[model samples]
Target: MSTRTLPPPPPPAEVRCWPDREALLADRAKAMAELHRLSIGVPRLLLLWLLACGLAVGWGLVGAALKTFEESRPDALSALFGVIFACTAAGFLIPTGIVMGLGVRRDKTVRERLTQWSSLDRDPTNDARFRSPGVSLCWFVPSFLLCTLGLWLSFATPATAERGQETYADVTMLMGLGLILWLTGLLGIAKAVSHFRWAVRLVTAVPVSAGDGGHR
Candidate 1:
């Protein structure tokens, strides 16, 4: 029987420990804590902002619907509506357009912010504990439905009030459209924020237990 000697198994590869990566990951929890601190005041600020927009839409809808400026002056309210809607649409589209326009700027910001934290790095592990991506879809769905309904209601009727004509439908539609956009905008903002927050958590993560026995 020939004893076969396998070349002494290649010297076990040297193990390398990446303490910096680990340290960064551990520090990510601090990012969440900082975010929490920021959110404490942010929620109320957001709430107030929301309340103000609601009031604007509410008052505008009431004013437009109750007042027959559109009907009384065929060219008047229609023109006013066009102007206001155009301005509002422009306002939203402008900033978003600018951000999206310079594609590099936005992407860079997202990538950089995700990797870094103003106060601490993002924790990759902690990100897993939060919500799923599909979570965002919930917020936009309502905006789509409401906006659709609002649009339908707005155009179905005549602007002028006559023996049987009413412009309330149009007014309601405008308001609904405004609200839909407003709410959807909020959802979009939230989604963007979440992405970066998650990104921060992701960048600072290191797989301590990857392949065989590793530093956990």
Candidate 2:
């Protein structure tokens, strides 16, 4: 990580003697783009999460086909239930392992992004720091809850096939949680993008001027 810092702003009196929109916008664009890049890591995380989810769903489909409840061939169904249970476990596990493995490839990228963000010049572009303290809280709370619930359900897979039967309740529980996490993340991204765009407007639209005979 680079310990570099952005050059500080000029003296208060000098900056206050201001005028042009174009110059202000240029400065605002530069700052916002940097912050925008820092947030890029978020999408990679999301993609990995979604892929894991898809893998889980694929197993669930296989499980559904093999289930034996309310059928005459109970023995065959029981054997099938064992197979289905095993499949489900393998399904979610593969994606999870892949994501964790991604930690190695993604760590340095994320770290560098954060490092650059730390060096940004303080300005309205930094509004993400303050915007939506409440929204941030709201997003995380549900995300945490759903993900936890999903993991709990996932761990109950073997039990789902005990005593020559299968119950879909646990599978449903996991699906519900996975859906919740997906929705929460999507909503968070939408809201964040909107808020960021608005802040950029406010910053660049504001004026910055130089008094007569000014030189950079």
All candidates: TM-score? 0.39, 0.38
Among these predicted structures, which one has the highest lDDT?
2
What Cα-based lDDT does every candidate model obtain?
0.44, 0.47
Query: Cα deviation of 92 in candidate 1 (Å)?
Result: 18
Clashes (candidate 1): 5
Scored against the true structure, residue 185 in model 2 reaches a CA lDDT of: 52
Compared with the true structure, what per-residue lDDT tens digits does model 2 show for residues 1-216? Answer: 222332223334344322454454455445445544433335534654565466556555544443443242557757677567657756665765565455434444443443333232334554454344454444455455655555555455544546545455445545544554554355444434544554454445433322232213
Give the range where candidate 1 is weakest over 10 consecutive residues by summed lDDT.
1-10
- Note the residue pairs that clash in candidate 2: 18-209, 19-208, 19-209
